[model samples]
Target: MRTPPTIPAHLPRLAARFDLSSEDLGNCAERCAARVQRLADLWSHAGTPPGQVMRTLRRTAKRHSVYMPQKDSAAECINRMSDPAWWRRALRKRFRAVELHAIQTGAVHRHASPYVSAKALRRHELNAARLAAQMDGLEAINQTTGEAVPMSDLIEASLANPANRRAALMARIKGIETSALAKSHVGLFLTITCPSRMHPRHSMSGAPNAAYDGTYPGRAHAYLSRVWSTATRRAAHLGLTAYGLRVVEPHHDACPHWHLLVFTPADQADAYADNLRAYALADSPNELGAQERRFTVKRIDPAKGSAVGYVAKYVSKSIDGEGVDFDSESDNDGRAAARRQIAWARTWGIRQFQFFGVPPITPTRELYRVSAAGLPGLALPELHQACKANDYAAWLATVEAHELRLGVDYAERESTRYRGETTKAISGLTVEGGDLTQPLSLVTRCDTWRIEPRAKGQAQAPSERAATGSDFSPWTRFNNSAPIDAKGLFPSDAPRAKTEKKGEEGETAVRGSVLHRAPLPGAGRGDWESARPAA
Candidate 1:
C-alpha cells in the first residue's frame, strides 16, 4: 500500500477556503516533497552507477553543454549528488520519474492492504511485470475441472486444434454464464473492426510487409479511438445502458481489432444487431467506405454460451501469443512476426485489455458470490474501502482486524473428513472473489445456497431449485465427485478412499479420492492441478 498523506492541521479551514472533497485528502499518498526526495536520492552518486552517471552527463551536455557545471570527478559528482533538489530536477528532465505510476489499487494484496504496487524495479523489469500480473482480476474456473487456467491460453490452444475448438468454445460459453455479470444480464458478443488495409501502411520509411511495422500501433489506436468514441455515442442514442468486457487483438499484419462481450438490459437482445449497424454507420459516411460491415453483435444464449469465456479468451490471447497474430492458419514465420509486434508494443508501453466504459462487474456482486457459495473470503466493504485510499495506516488496521488465510487453508478446514488432523485424499475445491484478500466464513453463514454437482451425461445444468434439494456442501460433493467430460481435472493416479469424522449434521464424512500435489509442467503458479475430480 502507498503510505497515506498526513492531514494538514488546517485542512478544515483549507477545505472551506477552497471547496475540496474528502476523497481528495483520502486519495493523497504523501506530501509532494517526500516523493521528490526519494526519486532524487536514487539518482545520487551513491545511488546511481557508472552507466547512469555517463548517461546523466551525456544528457546534461546535450542540454546547453557550454554552461555545464565543472563537477566531473568522482568526489565532485558525490558532492553534487548530495543536493536532493538538483537530482530531482535532473531525473525529471531525463526520465518521467514524476509521471511515475498509476498505483492501481485492489490489483494485489499484501498482508496488510488490498492494493497493487507498481514501478520499474531495479534490473528486473520482466520479472517485476509478471509479479504485478498477480493482481489481474479472476475469471471463472473451468466448471468440469475446477482448474483456473488463464482464459487466453485455453482459447488459443482450443483454436489451434480446430478439431476440438468448437467444444472448447462452447465450454467457455457456459463458464461465462456462471460468472456474476453474464449470469444476470443479457450479454452480446460484439465486434468493432477497423477498415482492413489491403497492404501494410507506413507513415515513416519502411517496407509495406515489414515484420515489425512502426506505423501499426498508431493506425490501429487511431481507428479504435475513432470508432469507440462514436460507438458509445450511438449506444446513447439507442437508449441502451452498455457495459463491455473487451479484448484488443492484433490483426494479421499487426493492426488492432476488438472482441467484445457487451451486457445491456436483458430485454434488448432482439434489437441489438440493427442498432449496432446504425451505430457503426453513424460516423462512417458511405463515401469513405465506413459502412463496410465493420460491426457485429450476437446475443449470447444463456443455455449454452457465455460472455465471460468468450471475451476472456481474447484477453489471454494477447499475451500467450506474446503479441503474435491470433490466427491459427499462420505459419512459423507469421507467428514469429506476431511475437515481435507484441514485444515492440510492450516496449512502447501499450495497454492490453483496456476499457472504454464501466467495467461489467461490480465488487459487491463478487463478494455476494463468495458469500453465497459458503466460501471463506474477505469482507467486501472493508476491502472495497482499502482499495480506494492510499493510507498505509488503514491498510495495517485492516490486516489487524481480519484473519486472512489462503484458499487452500479454507478448503482443508471445510473438508468434513479432514475437519480435524487426519490426512486423506483431497477432492473438489471452491474458488471465489477478486484480487485482494478474501473473507473467511462470509457465505457459510448464509442460510441459502445452490450447489451444482457434476454427474454423468448431464448436458443441461439442473435448475437452481433442484440443486438446493440435495446435500451439496464441499464435503458431500467431494465425496461423491464424478467425472463429467474430457475437460475433467484429475491427478494422473487416483488414491484409495478411507473413513472420516462426522459433522454437526450427523452425516459421515467419506474419505476423498482427490489429493493436492504440485501442478504439472507449465501449469499456473501455485495452482492445485494435481488433484483431479473424483471419478
Candidate 2:
C-alpha cells in the first residue's frame, strides 16, 4: 500500500500568503497565458520581430496548456501528463515571476525580454526546480530524523571561518614584500617538515623511547632553524636579494608535518631548492643517534593554480570509536587477546575526544524534514520575507506555495520517476584561489605574485649591484607639478614622493625640489592642505 505525502508544517502560512488552491492556481495560469498572448498580438501588429513574437506566443501557449489541467485534476489525473512538454511548461509557469523580475531589473541579458525569450523562462524554471530538489532532499532527511536543520548550520559545519582564512593569507603576502618582488615577476617561499614515529608502549605507558623520547620531536628542528638562518644571510650570493619564509605545522594522519612558504627570484629558485635538499639530507635525526635524515621539496606556482588550502588534519583520537589501536595484533593469540581487551575497554566507557583541526558538524536528514514539513505552497514574496526573517521554516513555506501555485500535477508525477541529466554546461570563468566548491563570484580580488626565470638576453646593468639601503630610497618619487597645500604639503594623489638620491661619492643628497610627507600626521590635519611637509 502507498502512503500519502503529508503537507509540510509551513503550509498554513503559505496558504494565507497566496491564493494557491488548485482552481485559483489554474485561473492564474490562464491569466498569465492570456496576458502573454495579448503582448504577442500587440508586438506582431507593431512590426516586432517575427522570431520574438512567435517565441512568446508559443511559450505562453505551452505554459498555460500544461498547468491548466494539472491544477483542475487530481494527482492521478495530472500524473498521466508526464511528457517532456508538460514537465517543461509546468516549470516555466512555476518560475514566471523570477523570469519577469530578471528581465525588468535588467540583471540578465538585455535581449532577455520575458515576452520574447522562451530561453529565459526555461532557465529560471530549471534553476528553481534544481534548487527546490536540493531543499526537498534536505527536508526529507530532517523529517526522517524528526529535527530542524538550518542552512546556516550546514555552511558553518562544512566550511572554515572566512575571517581566519583571510588573515592567514594576508600575513603570507605581507612577509613576501609584494611590491619589491613584483618587479622580478617571481614569488619564493621556504618549506620545512619533520616526521617522527612513536612506540606504542612508550606513548601508552608514558615511558621515553630511545628514538623518540617525547623530547626534541625526534627530528632536527634546531638544525633546520640554523640552516635557514645561514641561508638567509647568504641570500644575495644566490641572486636572491628579497625573500620571505613562514613555518607551519599541518595536521595529518595523527601526526605533525612542517610546512614552509618561501619566495625568491625565479632564476635563483633552483639554487635555493638544491641547497635546502642538501641541508636536509646532511642533517642527522635528533633522537635517531647517527641515522641521517632526508626531506622532500616541491616548487609550487600560484599563477598556475598550484596552491591548495592549507588546512591541518592530524591523526588524533576520533570523536566516535574509530581509529587505530596500537595494541591490536594480527597473530591468532594476539587477536583473541586484543578482542577481549577491546570488549573490556568498551565496558569502561569512552572519554570525550576532540580532533586538532575542524570537526565534522553536518546536519542529519531528520532536521530538514522537520523544517520542510512546516512549509507548503509558498509564493516568492513570502519566501523573500522568510529569508529576511532568517526563518528556515518560513522559507520552506514559500517553496510549498510556489509548488502549489505552479500546480503539483506534472512536477509531482515527474519528480517521482525523474533522474537528473548527466551533462552540464561549462562555466567560462576560472578561479585562482580557494577550493573548487567555493563560489567564484564571492571572490573580490586576487593578490597576484609571480616567479619567472630571468631572460637570458637581459644583461645586468654595470651599476646594478646587490641591493643596499642607498640603492632603494625610503621615499618614493613624487610629481611636483601639482599644487602644494597651505602647509606646503604635496597633493594627496601624487604618484610618488622624492627622497635622497645616491651620488657618485656615495653621499645622500636631495635630488628633486618635490615636497614629501612625514610618516605620521600632526593634529588638526584634515587633508593635504592641513598636513605638514617633509624636510
Candidate 3:
C-alpha cells in the first residue's frame, strides 16, 4: 500500500485560522481537485509526474491561506490560484485606506504597511505639514500681487529687469533715441533667407515636412544670425546705439527663414532698408555669388498690431502634413526639390543669428512706472469735453436717435459698440453746427416738410407735389408762347433719361434743364436767366 502523504507544515496553521464548515471545505476540495487534474496535465507534458506537481503546489498554497484537501487538489489549487486577479481586485477596494494607513504609519513598502517605525511616521507627517504651509504662503503672495497691473507694464518690466537677458537690448534702443539717430520711430520686420539648404539625411521630399530640428540650427539659422549681427553693427555706425531686435527662425518647404523686428526712425526707413539689404548680402565676395543670393526685408508697422501675431505663427507652427496639399504632384516635386536645396544651402557656410538693439536702459524704470499706473478709468468727462469741443454733439444725437429707434437698453449697452469705454455713457445732448454751447435741435429746422408713401398708386397731395416740384413751372422760350407745362416739358411717362447728355453750341452737353436754365452758372454771366431769358 502507498504511504499516506505528509501534510505541508503550513497547512495545519492555515486550517486553524480559516476553519470552515465541512460542507464549505468539501466545495473547496472539489475545486482544488479539478485544479490538480489540470496541473497534472500541464506538468506531465514536461515529464513531471502529477504526484510531484501536487507536492510543489501544496507547499506554495499553504503560505497564502489556500488549502488543498488532498495532494491532487493541492496541485489544482496552486495552478488555478497563481493568477493574482482576485488579490488585485481586493487591493483595489482598499487602495485609498491602504494609502492613508501607509502615510500615517510611515510604511516603507506596500506589503509591509504594519511594520513602520514611529520615527518614520512622524517624519512623513512633518513633511506633509511643511508642504501645506508652503502652498498657503504661495497663495497669499499671489493674492497680494494685485490684479490691476497692466499687461504692458508686465512686458516692459520683464524686458528691463536687471536680471533679464534682454537688458542689453533695452539699453541699445534707448541709445538710438537719446543720441538723435532716430526721431519718432516705427518698428520693422526683416525677412532673411539663407543660401544654405538642409542636409539630405533629414530631407522629407514627398509631403513637405515643415518641422524644424533644434539640433541642427541649419544654414538658414546661421545666415540669419550673421544678418542680425551685421545689421546691429550698421545701426551703431548710424548713431543708433540703442536698438532692440528679435530674430526668429521660420521654415518654409523645409528651408529656413528669419523674421526680425527692429525699431528705427520713420524718415530713415529707406536708408535703413538699403543698409540692411547690403549688410545681409555682404557675404558674397564675388559678383556671381552676390547675384545668386538675396536677402528680403520688410518693415513692421506697430500701428497694425500684427507684429506679435506674425512672429508667433512661425515659432509655434509644427511641420505636420496638415497644411500640405499631398494630392498635387507638383507639390510633391517641390517638396523634394526643397529638401535638396536645403542640403545645398548648407554649402554656403551661412549660420543663423537674430539681433535687436536694446531700448534706453535709463527710461525703462520710468516707463515701467507709467505703464504700471494702468489705463485711466473711462475718461468720460474728457471725452465729453472733446466731443463738445469738436462739435460731436450731432453725432451723439444721431447715436441717441438710433438707440431710441432700436429700443435697446442704452445703459446696458456695451461701450465697445460705440468705440468707447464701458464706464462712460454717450449723452444725448450735443451742440449744433459744432457750436459747443448750442443745442443740436436749435441749429437746424425742417422749415418745409412733407411725407409721401413709398408704395405705388399713392396720390401725392398738392403741397407734397409742389414740394416735390410736381407743380413747378417748366422752362419756356421768351417768344410769348404758352409757358411750357412743367409736366409736359419733362414727362415722367417718358423713358428714363440717359446718364450721359450733350449741350448746345455743338459741344457735348448734359441734358435736363435747370429749374431756371442760363448760360452755364460758372461762365461769369451773373444769373443768366435773370439777365437774358430771350438769349
Candidate 4:
C-alpha cells in the first residue's frame, strides 16, 4: 500500500535531451531527491530565473561524456548524472565567488573587486603565511652526499624568491642588451590587449559589461596567447627576427594584457611593429577603441635608459612590487597590486613572463648546481665555466658556438624519474634537432638529491662556498635546494611521496612528506627555471 514516486514535470525534457527514458529520469530524480532539492535551493537563493536555471541545467546535462556518440554508454551517463560531483561542478561553472556566496550564506555582500576580490586576496595571504610556517624548520638532504641544508636557505638559492627571479631576469636582459649592442639591434617596447568582448567587467567603473561574451579569465588568456603565437609566426614569415621578454599583467577587472620588450635589427623594427599590430587588431577590427587602444609600440632609447630599466618596474610590479609606488591601471599601491597580480595569476593558471628566440638556460642553471669539485672534465667545459661564472655575455657566446637557438636549432630534453624510484632522478638539458646522439647534445644536470624533514633541534648546515672561477655564489649563504614538488616533498614530475597507508575518507593519516614550494604558473610546461638570453 505504498504511494508511487512523484517525478518533476521537466522529466520529459531531460529524458529527451539525454536520450534516456522518462522512467529512468523519474527514478534518478527520486533516488537523488536530496541533491535535486539542494540544487533547487541554490538556484532559488541566488534568485536565478526559471528559464536561465533550465538553460544551466541543460548545459550541465550536455557536458557529460556519454552525450558524445560512441564515447560512453547511456548506463554510464545515468551513473554520472546521479553523482554529486556532476551537479557541484556544473554550479561552480555557472557561478563565481559572488553568486556562490549568495547561495551559501543567504546574504549578498558587495565585492569591490579592483584587480582581485578582497576575499580572494585575504585567502591568498593566509595560505602563503601558512605555507611559510610549515617550511620553517624543514631541511633538504642531498641523497648523493648526505648533505643537509635548511629548506629556507635552499629556497633563496633557487629562483623561487621574487628577489632572485628579478635578478635573474635583469641579468638575462642585460645579456640580451650586450648581444643587441654587438649586433647593432634596436629595442622596441610593445603592448597588446584583448578585445572588449573578452572582458566581462569595465576597467574604470568596475561595472559588468552587457556585451561580454561570457569568457573567463583563463580562456581570455588563451586568446591572448593565440594572438601572440599568430603574430610571431607572421613576423617569422616576413623574415623579421627579434628576441626578448614578454610580461603578462592583469587589468583592473582582471583581463590580461601583454608588455613586450624585444630587440630587433634596426631595419626590421618598423616592419616587426606593423606585423604585430596587424595581427592584434585583426579580431574585432571595428570595435570601439580597437583602432587606437589595441596595440602600441615605442622605441627604447639607450640614452634615456637601458632596455632592462624600461621594463624593470613591470617585472618588479608583477613579481614582488619592490620599488613600485602605485599602479594607475588598478589604482592600487605596489604591494597590494602585486598581491592581486599573484592571486589573479594563481587563480587562472597564467604564465606571467616568458622569453623567446633564446638558447635554453637549463644548462646554465644545472652548471650552477654542480659543486666546484664536479666542475672539471664536464662536457662543454667553456660553457660550464661561463655559466658558473655568472657571465651571461660569455655564456651566450658559448651557446652560439654550438649553433643553438630556441625554436630554430634545439629542443629540450627534460629530467625524468624511472618507475618506483623516488631517490634517483635525472636533470634536464637541451638537445640539438631533438636528437640525443647529435654532437650538440649536452647533459648539464649530473646530481641527484633527496629531501626529508630535519630532525627536531637539528643544527643548520654550514653554507657551501661559491664555485671556483665564479666571483659570487647565489647559494653561498643557503646551499642549493631541490626543485619544488606539489607536496613540498623533493622534486618529482610524478605524484608526491605518500604516507605509510592511504587515508580512508574523513580519516587523518600522517603524511611522510612536507609541502614543497609552489611552482610558477602553468604546471605542465617545461623550461620554467631557465632559458638563455639571445646571442
The candidate that achieves the highest lDDT relative to the unseen native structure: 4
Give the per-residue lDDT of model 4 (tens digit) for 301-400: 9889888778988898888887789877767688777888897776556899998987656555544443333222333556656665556767787667
Per-candidate RMSD, Å: 21.1, 32.1, 35.2, 15.1
Error of 1 at 427 (Å): 35
In model 3, the runs with Cα more than 4 Å from the true position are: 1-186, 197-215, 218-223, 240-244, 252-256, 284-294, 299-355, 360-535
Q: Tens digits of per-residue lDDT for model 1 on 2-33?
A: 42132234433432432222233222212323
Per-residue lDDT of candidate 2, residues 1-535 (tens digit)? 2211222344334324332433455456456645654664566478776556445544654644434343322232223233333444453343333322222232222122212123433443455455433432331011112322222222212212222222222322332333324445354333454434322112223222334322221123344456656765565576554333343221111112244545556777777666665554454445452223335455555555322222111111111111224322211232322232222222222221111111111111111111221222233335434432323334334444344121101101112222321212111112112222322211111111111223344322213322321222221101111111111121231123233333322111011111221111111111111111133
TM-score of 4: 0.63
| Model 4 per-residue lDDT at 426 | 28
Per lDDT, what order, best first? 4, 1, 3, 2
Candidate 1 TM-score to native = 0.35
What digit string (tens of lDDT, one per residue) describes model 3 on residues 209-327?
12322112234456566776777688668865434445443232323556565556677766776777777676543434343445555666445654434443222221112222331
Clashes of 1: 13
C-alpha TM-score for every candidate: 0.35, 0.24, 0.26, 0.63
User: Which window of 10 residues has the lowest lDDT sum in candidate 3?
Assistant: 441-450
Q: Which has the higher TM-score value, candidate number 2 or candidate number 4? A: 4
Question: In candidate 2, how many Å is residue 437 off?
Answer: 52
Local distance difference test scores for all models: 0.36, 0.30, 0.33, 0.56
